[model samples]
Target: MTLDPEDSKLITLARAARARNEAAEGAAVRDETGRTYSATNIALESLTLSAVQVAAAMAVSSGARSLEAAALVTAGEGPSAADTAVTGELGAGALHVAGPDGVLRS
Candidate 1:
C-alpha cells in the first residue's frame, strides 16, 4: 500500500529505530542516560518514535540535533548539505504532539 508522507516518514523512522536498537543491544549501551550518548543511542531514540510521540521527542531531539549540527559547523565537521537537508525534513515538526491533558471538573 502507498503510504502518506507521514506514514512513509513513520515507516522510515521505525526501521531506522529498529536497526539502532539492534546495534545498541549488541554494544550493551542500554543504560548510558547520564553519560555520553553513542550514535546508536541517538539514532535509536529518534527512529523508534511513533507518529503520536514524534512531536515531543522531535521537540527535544530537533533542538539537540540543531545544536550538534551547529557545533559541527563551527568546528568544520558539520554534516554535508544533503545531510542537513534530509535532517531538516525529518525534524520533529512533522509530528503531532499537542493535545488536551485532561478535562477538569468544576
Candidate 2:
C-alpha cells in the first residue's frame, strides 16, 4: 500500500528505534494532532509491552484523543492483537508493519 510522506516517516522512525536498540521490535504512531510517538518493545521481569502498545500509550498519555496512523517494525509475522486493539480504540486506522529494512510487511 502507498502511504503519505508522514506515514513513511513514521516507518523510518520505527526502523531506527529497532536498529538503535537491537530489540525485537519498534513502533511509531501519529496522533490526530499530527504529533508522533516512537518506542521499542519492553520486556522485563516485571513488565512486558509491545512496541506498538508503548507508542499508543505514549500518545494517549500525551493528550492525543485519536490517532491518524501507526507503524511497527519487526521480524515477526505481524503486529500483536494488543497493538490493533489500542489503535482501534483510539481511531479506525490501519496498522502498518514493516521489516528492519523499512519495507512494509503488512
Cα lDDT tens digits, model 1, 4-101, are: 44333333443344355543211101111211112222335446522222322343453433212100111122234543443354342221111112
- lDDT scores in order: 0.27, 0.91
After TM-score superposition, what is the CA distance of residue 76 in candidate 1 from its true location, in Å? 42
lDDT of 2 by residue, 13-63 (tens): 899989899989999999998999999999999999999999999999999
Model 2: how far residue 50 lies from native, Å? 0.2
User: Clashing pairs in model 1?
Assistant: none
Candidate 1: segments with Cα more than 4 A from true spot:
23-55, 60-106
Q: What is the lDDT of candidate 2?
A: 0.91
lDDT of 1 at 24: 25
